[model samples]
Target chain A: MISRHGTPEHLPVRPFVALVALAVSVATFLWAGTAFAQASAAWPRVSPITIVINQSPWFGGFSKVVEAYEKETGNKVTLDVNPFAGSGEKQRNSVRSKEGQFDILVMNSAWLAEFYHGGFLTPLNTIDPAFKLDPQVMSYDDTGYWDAARKSNNAKTGVVYGVPINGNIQVLYYRADLYEKAGLKVPQTWEELAANAKALNSPPNVYGMVQRGARSASDISYDWMPYLHSHNGAIFKDEKAGDFTVTINSPEARQALDVYVNLAKTVGPPNPGSYGQAQVIQALLTGKAAHATPVIAAWPQLDDATKSAVVGKVNVAVLPHGPGGRTTPTLGHFIGGIPNNIPKDRQVAALAFLRWFQSYDAQVKYAQTGQPPIRSDVYAAAFMKTPEYRWSPAVLASLPNAKMMYTVPEGPQIASVLELRLNQAVLGEKTTADALNTAAAEIHDLMQKAGYKTARLPPLK
Target chain B: MRGTADRASAKAADRWRFYTLAPALAVYLLLALLPIVNLATMSVHDIHWQQGAARWTLVGMKHYAELPRDVLVRAGLANTALFALIAVTAEMLIGFALALFVSRIAVGRVLYRTIFLLPILLPGIVIGAIWKLMYNPDFGVINQLLHLLGLPGFDWLGSGSLAFLSVIIVDVWHWTPFVFLLLLAGLETLPQDIHEAAMLDGASAWQELRDVTIPMMVPILVMTLAFRLIVSFKVFDEVYLLTGGGPGTATEVLSFTIYRRFFTEDRMGYGSAISVIALFLLTLVIVLFMGMARRRMHAH
Candidate 1:
């Protein structure tokens, strides 16, 4: 079997195989080096992150924003939108199971404390090492947002839990035409509001004021907080207490309740107690109600010129003041935070997306699409110069006087308690004094049950 | 000696049969009994919801003890019971009458039957949304109709009593078709000669229905009633979508409470305890009704 060239045929094949093997090894090394070089050029391997949000109109254009983000960064993004009323429950369950299904939570500011208390939220600092919020994004109108939005860690250390994506406040939405027709100025006080409502009130045609008095507790109570605040009533005595005293059963609160009930019973919808935001929005847009309150984020749809009959007639103003002074609206800002248990990669992506979303440019885009901007600079930005959003100026003017609801570990739960009692008053099931007193008792019991060191103080004056 | 061998072989065959069923029994135990066992275990512990199955602090009988004291749980139970009792009775009576009328019709009987079954076929959530819109205060079709007739429109889901009644009416609307279809099937199978003979004997319509139809249809009636009871006890969707246990706990039922306690409150231990009790009660009621039915059938 020897070849004429002087070596065996099989012996020559061994050297040829060795040469091919050497070439393959060299090529593999070069290919790997090229891949590493490209990777070093940009952080390329960002896994998909899922964000859980409620189905609010403010989030209407979010899918497009997400698609844009995904296209720019080659990373997949998932949105898990739940109905607003049920989003809290879904988020709480996500917290309980510590599932990595949701990397980010776009939730109510009222819910931040509970999620933080339960160790469901990741500290904003932990989500990124090189994170710096625009100073404008940090506060507005001298509102120090770190304390405004809890400055604490799950281990009870110094940390920020969430960033405010929306600086939402309640505004009184009124039919300017109706006020003109009735020869009434925009009511500035509770007495004036009541009188105006009584004057314009007509059954089955144009009832006076509309109120959300439904019994879901949080929804109904959030709107009613401004009324109590305008009357100088506080739901709790202190925010930092382990167990706070309930001081809601004040003469001021009773008076607020009396006004609320009288408005609802005399001039409001036939079943005012059944009214939620949906009903209120319908009433306001159709010009069925002469006035409405706490018309939050809903102004977009209610004032859409093509969609609404009252487009040119609706005006925004401060909620009616009380004897205490001008009314202070309650804050239920939409806040965004990462959950504690998602992958590190997702944590980075979520933080990047959040910062990009709340950027001044993004805020302009959001403002143009009817989303309220969280930053003060967004107001001074060129977008705010033009009035695409009719409600922006009023929102900015109201910003200085806006106040955060109690940021306790059980704020929403306690909010519901306030809601139920206020609702009972609105429904005439309990006298104002009795309703507030009962709510105070229940609030005390709830605080005690949560293992708080509790006390109950009498209402101020 | 031969007979003894045969007997031993028969016993061995029986053992083989049971062995053949072992794989199915094992799967059933894993899929069904394991959750029940897990629920019982959870009910005993103070569950750290975040660390759910991985960790727990043992606190026996605490949740069970609290069940009786919880006002919401009691109200939910009462509402569920009242909903089942009233809804089932009305559905059965109306379903029976409709079934009889349709069974006797000589023209367009198929169309009538199809129309009656439409509500039952629709998704509960869709039905709920439709009802909620119809119950709206300002622009609901019902209110519009009333206004046209120069009558005042009532706030249907606004008042406590009215909210409860409206939810009941919706449930009845959704499920009465189920009763109608089941009873109609039974009516179709009934022999016609019996009715003809009753007529020839000069027995009035009422007499024929009371004496002959009642006795013959008892089994179907009982079975339909039993099915309706089981289904009604589990009502959640309509109540949830329509009233959400509001204007204030007016329509909150056991199932809705279970969801709220577990998911909303994150009280897994307490919620599981309630779930265990609910499962047991529902099972007992179904079994009791079925057992009585079986006994009555055998006696007949």
Candidate 2:
């Protein structure tokens, strides 16, 4: 039907349809332009990168640092926090999945070998040739490198695979008030520490000492590593030298075991074999024990008035030395790395985050958040001089002398054996010599089966 | 002609029955048999992840051969067997007694049933955590009670000798209610005419229970025992949260070992091999129990 003002009504409708088409074309052009602009602006990444980390004392601080990173870079990051054991499983699953789940893997020192040996990680140097690990951060006994040709972890020649995130190391936690009352100077050797334990010896009311002798996958063995390493004993003859000899049953190790067992049996809690990290910390905070060697990360609870009965009474010191040996704390640092399975863009984004994380400012923020800073400069920060940060000095002093348990991928599997046997020894189920010998034998069989040239020490006669 | 038509109708009914079952059977096969087949395939191969892809290296019978020598596997087998035997027996006996006591009650029966079933209502993980705190030597209620009595406190789950027993106690406490509920249902469904007949014959209550009621309840008892035994064999949460196969593998069970191998050790091939064996053993148990049940029912 024709309209009165126009030649035809459909002629007026033609312009309306044209207007609609023109608007849609303009909208499509604008949308495409904005998307292209975003693609250009969001260089290297548009999707969020995920970091898999275990829940630990430093997790809060680490999460804060991650938030700082996100704010600074405008890059999205998903912090996939899991329980300690669950994190490892998550990392393994992520790396093994068809498309990896995590961009960054926060690996425990114990499991670093598995990641490194399995080629599951992307070497940082390969990502950026000029990206050098900050020298101020603790090297964790050169755990960041893997000598692919030598099949060993060595900082001097191996490729850089990870950066230290949490500077975790064992430190001697002691009741300073008890020491003052007993008129005892700080112990310089394991022997002296033991003597002091004997002096402060009391049961039920207060144990002379409490040790983490529980047999989780690696708890007891981890607690005993300080003793073992300080005693000039090693799980291998020389892991750095590519020597795969099973030396856990060496005479030095036997003596170390003897000391560990004696302290656990005589001075520790009644159920020391069941005392994991939590139990040890509880014993210290409640003033039920006078001494312990928990990770420095646990130092925050010592002075927390809300949790501690003996606040301001505890002090930190380097783990005592063995005869003819220097103080050696066990390195329990958590290192962060990119898995090889992720997309190149994600890998780049992860590397960028790590690079920013290692900056001096980030380290300072990390320290401010009550996390153990990995950098030496952060350890010497003004805030560390306060009474609350009293443990920082000892942690700094101990980290340089810290040693990783093993540099082999078999570290965890082998640690399982030691954890069980050492726990048995602590519980008086096996003699120290018998336990060490059995551990060495089992480790030898394991390494050999894994196609390593390994041999155990002769049985302790 | 009429007989032939009836025969043809029966054959058509059989065809209809087959058609009715086909879809369900296909779905069951797809869900169940595929995983079993995949597990079998994995057991014969050494699997390694390379750039997020599983690289399968054929190593036929290697993992299976290593199973016998694996100390953890052996310990797991022994502990699992021991745990099933003791825990199941305790649950069955205690459950039977509770069922008998509740069935005879004329008042507050529903309340007693609810109270008895409370343990099973709690999640296994929650139960494990609660029991762990209760067993703690320092501040736990068990030791605190002992201390109040001026007696020495004992480390219940810490000692190698006591850890396994402590776990068993937790299992028995948690699952007894399950058995009780089942047995009570069985008791409720038992015909009352037999009990009345026995009473009219001047048989005592105990005699009626032993000779008339128990004999009638044997099939149900056997079925309940088998179910409890199967569940007990799969115990992991209690062991995981409480002892974690600690105090020198005292409480290590098959499921925990498989968990360690798969998750902790990342030995998928070996873990699958262990799983295959466990599945086979469990299936055998199920088959044997069903056979026994059928035979007992036939005898009755």
Leading candidate by TM-score:
2
Residue-level lDDT of model 2, residues B1-300, one tens digit each, is 999999999999999999999999999999999999999999999887544466799999999999998878999999998899999999999999999999999999999999999999999879988999999988999999999999998899998889999999999999999999999999999999989999999999899989998989998898899888788889899999999898888989999999988778778888999999999988898898789888877887
The TM-score of predicted model 2 comes to 0.91
Clash pairs for candidate 1: none
Docking level for model 2: acceptable
Q: What is the TM-score of each candidate against the true structure?
A: 0.85, 0.91
How many residue pairs clash in all the candidates, one count each? Answer: 0, 0
DockQ (C-alpha) of model 2?
0.43
Quote the lDDT for A236 in model 2: 89
Superposed model 1: Cα runs more than 4 Å off: A1-47, A67-76, A95-99, A138-157, A241-243, A385-387, A458-461, B1-18, B48-55, B191-204, B287-300
Candidate lDDT scores, in order, read 0.77, 0.87
Candidate 1, residues A1-461, lDDT tens digits: the string is 88887678877677897999999999999997776666444435466788888887667756666776665456678889888757777777676664657888877766666665556767677667666566677342222223323433222334555666666778888888888887889788978988888888876777789888887636678777788878887777665543366777877777777777888888898868888877787788778888888545777777688768887788778788889666788876777878877778888878877867767766766666676777778877766666456577778777777766776656655775776678777877788888888888778877786666666656423
TM-score of chain B of each: 0.89, 0.95
DockQ of each: 0.28, 0.43
Across B1-300, the per-residue lDDT of candidate 1 in tens digits comes to: 999999999999999999999999999989999999999999988655231233488888988998997656888899998999999999999999999999999999999999999998889889988998898766789888999999988788988878999999998899889999999999989899999999999999999999889788989999899989999999989887898788777787999888767655556788899999999999998999899988987776
